[model samples]
Target: MEYKVIAFDVMGSDNGLIPAVDAAIKLLGEQKDLKIIFVGDGAALKKELSSRKHNPDQVEIYNTTEVIEMTDGIMDIRRKKDSSMVRALELVKDEKAHGVTTGGATAPFIAGCHFILKKIDGIERPGFMPVIPTVVKGKITLLLDVGANLECDPEDLVNFAVMATAYSKAVNGVEDPKVALLNIGEEKSKGMELHQKAYKLLEDHEEINFFGNIESRYLASGIVDIVVTDGYTGNIALKAAEGMGKSLLTEIKTALTKNIFRKLAALRLRKAFKEVAAKFDYKNHAGAILLGTKSIAFKSHGSSDKVAFYATLKMTYNAIKNDVVNKLKKALAE
Candidate 1:
């Protein structure tokens, strides 16, 4: 087994570095073939590790005193050379690690990725690909450009489709992942000029299994394995889906706990409810991978706790182990 190393940006998280550190320590124990590098303040990291029981040989620390604040703009990526996020990314760039994961500010981390990691050859722009759960049990959909590029052309959509298809095959174990364009209606000509052009491009593309256009309503239905759209539209759809999932779950809880009889029923259905909750929980999903980059990079939620961090770390390790970047490159080259 080839050993894998994943770097974690241990600062800028809403809950601070402790969660990241704890998650890394736990992961190291489970994956004997994996090692971890924590990029952050040396003193704090050492202090935290002192209390945790982990294999010292599998852990390393690259100390950086600076941290990119949530308010920091994209330009700060270049300026903050010693920041935890940049250093963790640098680990991948320097070939010290196979992948990088962070619960840090999004914009600067993305900009840093564009500048430092660069894009895979032939990819015009990188897309934020998150593994979103579908209504179908144990099925997931890959939604791209959640906020990476505000606007994209037909070619970009095709590239996103190609990349997503490759990811679905390599990571999700799909034989031939079905791809769709998110539009106003299922009709090919229903959307704007961009969607129309994208539909034609995707339909003509031989690399992916194009499934035509999909409306936002059916995005979570697991009808398609991947959904491609411009960042502006995709971001709105993603947020709306998240909001609706949370609201529906909240309403269900309210309805089930309002009366004594309903409370008993809720108790009886506790396992089923947990299964549903786990499917929709952001913490379980963890990170949005920056697809089309030269190497694997993930942007975890800033508010993620230890569980979320662990999920992201495990994903990063698996992507590296599976050689996701090379598979994607091969797919694009074909």
Candidate 2:
């Protein structure tokens, strides 16, 4: 059939192969033109597929003798070439698949991609950038280096800005995505030397609409299209936002169900509340694209299940359709 091949690691998450298999089957039903390589234990995968009785033509399994676990480090990729994560990524490396997604350990996943796919030449290291959905309807912001480079040069930050800008334009349909450096304060001299240097580089960049510095407070306010930072700070920001999102969402539910009058009010705004909840549900698009890699590698949350895995499948499809890697190469070249 026509090749719209995608690869996924069936052994990536805590939920075993069930969620990945379910999502794969769902995706196959939704898109007939798609083909998938579910890389993992073949016997296990075949059992699951047999249970569902899906056609082998659409969803094929690549048997793996090894598996990279959460405790594995970067060197695990070297030792475990036959792992589901490595094997799935290999399909992308070999051009057998357009992209791959795995909810595996972050270190090995990045290591596997780096060791196999390599960086896109000009890129020093691949950065994990996630599109965060904001409270504003149809509004999303890109956050880069969420857990990639712990330390980065000013030019690296500039490259991230360039890459994310192109991604926003292609995927999110933003004409000119406003880019900002994440800083302790909005002032030019507020943070460390890295921020100062990166600020100058971004400010001087003609390609992106550099919006100076963006404090973390404005991240959820949807004031800018992209937020760039070193992984250390970015990771902190990501975790904090996640914790706050969960807390706030919990608080909302608790408050709404407090009494009869509030429950009645909640009943009235049920549709609206559900819509808002959906927007806040990052699990609905559960992953970040590893930009700067030779091939697209999607890193989903380790706990991701059926709905989350399905969301990453959609993300992989979008990245492939947009030719994200090539577009990023072109943008960085310019």
Candidate 3:
């Protein structure tokens, strides 16, 4: 069987390289046809792997002298060209790897991808697309332009829908995915000029199943498969949802242990509470893809733990296995 090689930039993560290294070893154990190039401090990575029992043939380390910090500026990609993040991306650019994953700063990582991987043919601009869980269990929605481009035009939003729809079909197994424009109202005339214009274009586009405008409050209602918006707005919405989920879970925990009666009640409802908590856990959906790029450039959470990092690695592997980049090109061309 043929193997797919993935370049993992295992630096600049908030928790250090342990999470990424542990996840890589676990992934290699299950995926026999996969190889991982851990791009970071060679000695440190080798030391971490020494205690872990993994197939030596499936792992390699590419030592880098530098790392891109979270505080680094956007142009640091050029200044720190020898950094782990840049080296990992280069593996894909040089056709040595099928994809790359990083837990680096958002700006430099996205910028590096744009300059290094370049855009897919016919893609005007790349967007950040993340899979989000909906209110319905086991269902997900794709949100794009989440801090990729600060602003976008109507045509760019349409391109995001096209890219997202292609992703939904290929990876999510959703055929003819229904897409919506995130707006203040459900009417066609809602939102800014960009949203209004995008609504019309999405409606006219034959490739996508346009579901019209959807209010932000309804995002978790599981009414749409994909939601398109500008980066500025999408970023805020994503953060707000993440913060709200955490706040609600905290509040529930506090309420459960307030008194003797509540504590007793909590014991009886522990399983139910866990199920609800799992549905809203951000760790379950921690990775976001820099779509419209020529290769899969996955950005895991900067503060990811082993569980979150593993989820991202699985996502990157699935993207490569499903040939998502080529499918995206076909979607745009058609």
Q: State the local distance difference test value for candidate 3.
A: 0.91
How many residue pairs in model 3 have overlapping backbones? 0
- Listed in order, each prediction's TM-score against the native is 0.97, 0.95, 0.97
Weakest 10 consecutive residues, lDDT, candidate 3? 276-285
Off by over 4 Å in 1: none
Per residue, candidate 2 scores C-alpha lDDT tens digits across 216-247 of: 88777888999999988998998898789889
Task: Give stretches of model 2 more than 4 Å off.
Answer: 53-56
C-alpha RMSD between model 2 and the true structure: 1.6
lDDT of 1 at 11: 94
Q: lDDT of candidate 2 vs native?
A: 0.88
Clashing pairs in 2: none
Positional deviation of residue 211's Cα in model 1 after best superposition, in angstroms: 0.3
lDDT-better candidate, 2 vs 3: 3
Worst 10 residues of 1 by lDDT: 1-10
